[model samples]
Target: MGLTDTPPPHVPSWVVPASGALLITGAISWDMCYVLMSIRSHRTKSYGMPLLALALNLSWELIYAARVAEHPLERLGFLVWLLLDVPLVYTTLKNAKHEWRHSPLVAENIGAVLTAMVALGCAANYAVADWWLSAPGTGFGDKSGKWWAGREGFDCTELAFWTAGLAQLALGTGCLAMLLVRGHSGGTSYAIWFCRALGTLTGWIGSTSLLWWYWPEAHGFFVNPMGIFLMTTCLACDTAYPFTLAVVRRSERVLSDGRLVSGISVKQSAAPIVKKRL
Candidate 1:
C-alpha cells in the first residue's frame, strides 16, 4: 500500500514527532562529524573518509533524495545531507593525492575514479530500491495480474531506513579499517568517531521504533537473523572505535622537536635520548 493510502501506524501522539526529531538530530550529528573530519583533513592534508565509503554515502544520499519524494520532511532531510556532503567530498578529493602518494597514477586520476565509482554506486542503489519496491511478498504488488506503472506499493520510509542503515554499516566499517591500517588519526579525531557512533545509535532507534509502531506486521524484519547480525556488528565496531583510537595515539611517539611520528623510524638526534656523560 502507498504511504498516503495507509493511515500512519497507531501510537501515542508524541511518538511520531519525537521520533522525527531524533532522526533529524541524528542526521545533523552525523554530518557534523564529517564537517569536523573535513576540517581536520584541511589542516593535516590527509584524507579522512575512505574512497569507497565516500562514494557509497554520496550516491545513497543523491539517489534517495531523488527517488523518495513521497515524504516531504524525509526528502528534505536527504537534501540537507547532500548539501553537507559537498564539503566532505571536496576535502576528500583535494587531499586524495597526498593521502595515496604511493601510487602516482591513482593520485593523478583520483577525481575521475571517484566520480565513476559514485555513478556505479548510484546505479546500484537504484537497483536495490527498485527491487525492494517490486519484489514479491516484500513489495507492494497485489496478486491481481495487472501491473501498475505509476502506482507505488511499498512504504518509502521503511525502504529508506533499511537502505541507509546498511549503507552506514558499510561506510562505518570501511572508515574504521582505514584508520587502523594507517596507525594514526591523521584526519579524524576521537570527537568525530564519538559523534558518528552516537548519531548512528540514535538514528537506528528512531527509525526502527517508527517502523515497529506503524507497520507491526513487518516487525519481524527487525528481529530477523540478518538484521540482528548487522546491528550487532555495527554496534560492536562503533563501540570499539574509541579504544582503537586511544591505542593508536599511545603507540605514536612524540619527538624531541615536538613532531609526532607513527610507524616510522625516528633518528636519535630527532628524538630525545637520555645519555650518561661519564
Candidate 2:
C-alpha cells in the first residue's frame, strides 16, 4: 500500500494554524454586516465595490483551502474563481481612479496594470501549477499521477507568482501615493489614508516573498504563510475603508439632525414668550 492511499496528517503551522478557516468564516461575517448596513442605510455607492472584492477573495480562499484539504472537486472551483477574477480585477482597478484621482500618471497606470496582472496570473498559476498534487503529503497524490505533475507543470509557475505579487505591489503603492498626495492637498479622509498605508506595508511583505521564491536557501517555510496573511490583511483593510467612511458620514448626519431639532425647539419656545409679552 502506498502512503498516498490514505489521507495526509493534519499538521498545522504557527504562522496561521487555522488562518484559512478563520479567513473564510470572518470574511462572510464581515461582508454580511456590510451588506446589512448598506441596505438599512439605502446607500449603495462606494460600498458595493469593497463588498464585491471581499466576496471574491473569500470565494477563492475557500477553493484554495479545500484543495489543501484534498477535496477533488475543489480544483474545479479554483478554475471557476480564476475565470471570475478577470472581471473582478478590472472592477477593483476602475474604482481606484475615483479613490485616487490625485494620483500621478505613473501611479494611476501602475494601479490599473497591477490589478489586471494579479488577477490574470493568480488564475493562471493555479490552473497550471504542478505543485498542487506533486508536493509531499498532499491527498491528491493518490488520484494524481506523474503525468499530471510533469516538469511542464512547474514551467513559469514562479513567473506567474511573481507577476501576481508585482501587481499587488503596484496597486498598493499607488494607493499609498494617492494618500500622500491627499494629505498634501488636504482632501483625503484619515480612514482612507490609513487603509492605503496598511496596504503598502503588506505589499512590501508580499514583494519580499517573491524575492525569496527566487532563492532556494532563503525560502523559510513560514515565508509563504506570513506573506499570504499580510496580503489578506492588507486587502481586508482596503475593503474596510468604505465602511469606515460610511460610519463617519452617518455620524455627521445624526449630529446635523440633532442640531436642527434643537434649533427648532428653541425657536418655538421663544416664539410663545414673545407673543404673550407683545
Candidate 3:
C-alpha cells in the first residue's frame, strides 16, 4: 500500500484539518479561476486552451473529493476528468509545439507529456491505496496486493505508480532546466525559481522514498510520511505559482515603464533592436 492509504494516526479536532484542507482546496481552485480571468483580460481569446486545461484539472480535484466518500458520483466525476484530459493534453501539446517553433526546449515539451501522465496516474494509485486501506491485517509492510492478487484482470496499477513517479521527477527537472535556460522576465523571478527548486527537490527525494518502499529492505511505513510531506510541498508550490506570476507581471510592468531599473546593467536594461536603419 502507498502512503496515502492510511489516514492520520492521530485524528486532530475534526474541524481543524478537514476545514483547513477544504478551505485551502477551495482557495486554490479560486486561484485557478483568477488565473483564467487574468489570462482572459490580458491576452486575446487565444487563452481558451489554458482555461480548458485549468478546468480539466479542477474537474480532477472535484472527482478526487467525491471519490474519498465512495459515492457513485465519484465515478462519473472522474470519468469527466478523464475525458477532459484528452483535449486539455492536446491543447497543452499544441502550445508546446508552438513554443518549440521558436525555442530549442524540445526536451521540456516532452516533459510536459510526462507531467500530464503523472497527474492522471494518481487516480489509479488512489484506487490501490483505497483497497489496501479497506483490507484487514494488512500490516504496514504488506506490499502484497490482497485486493488485487488473484484477480483475473490485468494489474497495471503498480506500474502506474512507478511510471507516474518517474514522470513527475523528469518533468520537474525538465522545467527547472528550461527555467534556467530561458529565464524570461516571467521565468527569472526569485519566487518562481525558488518554488520550482523546492518542488523539484521534494519530488526527487519523494521518488527515493517510493524506491525504498518498493525495495526489499524497508517496508512501506516511511513512504507514506515522506510522500505526504512531498505532496504538501507540491501543493504549496502550486499555490504559490499564481501569486508569483502576478508579482512577475507587476515587475515586468515596472521594468517596461523604466520605473525600477536600479541594479540592472546597461546591456541588461536595453531592449533588443528589431530593425536596423539603412
Q: Give the clashing residue pairs of candidate 2, or none.
A: none
Better of 1 and 3 by lDDT: 1
Instruction: Mark the regions of model 1 whose C-alpha exceeds 4 Å error after superposition.
Output: 1-10, 134-153, 213-215, 253-261, 264-278
User: How accurate locally is residue 264 in candidate 2, as Cα lDDT from 0 to 100?
Assistant: 19
TM-score of each: 0.80, 0.33, 0.38
Give the per-residue lDDT of model 3 (tens digit) for 140-238. 443433233333222222332333333343433343344333222321344434433443343333333433433422235335654455445544544
Which consecutive 10 residues in model 2 have the weakest lDDT in total? 257-266
lDDT for each residue of candidate 2 in 1-278, tens digit (9 for 90 to 100): 01012112332222222322332333333334333423322221111233223333433344344433233333443454445444444444444454344556734685555656446544644553345445433221122111222322211223223333444444444434432332221122443345334434433343334323332232232256644764675566556544544444443322222210011111345544344554
Query: Predictions ranked by lDDT, top down?
Result: 1, 3, 2
User: Scored by CA lDDT, what does every candidate get?
Assistant: 0.70, 0.36, 0.38
Q: State the displacement of the C-alpha of residue 61, model 3, in Å, after optimal TM-score superposition.
A: 10
- The list of candidate 2 runs beyond 4 A from truth reads 1-23, 29-116, 135-178, 181-220, 223-278
lDDT of model number 1: 0.70
User: Local error of candidate 2 at 273, Å?
Assistant: 66
TM-score between candidate 2 and the true structure: 0.33
Cα misplacement distance, residue 26 of candidate 2 (Å): 3.4
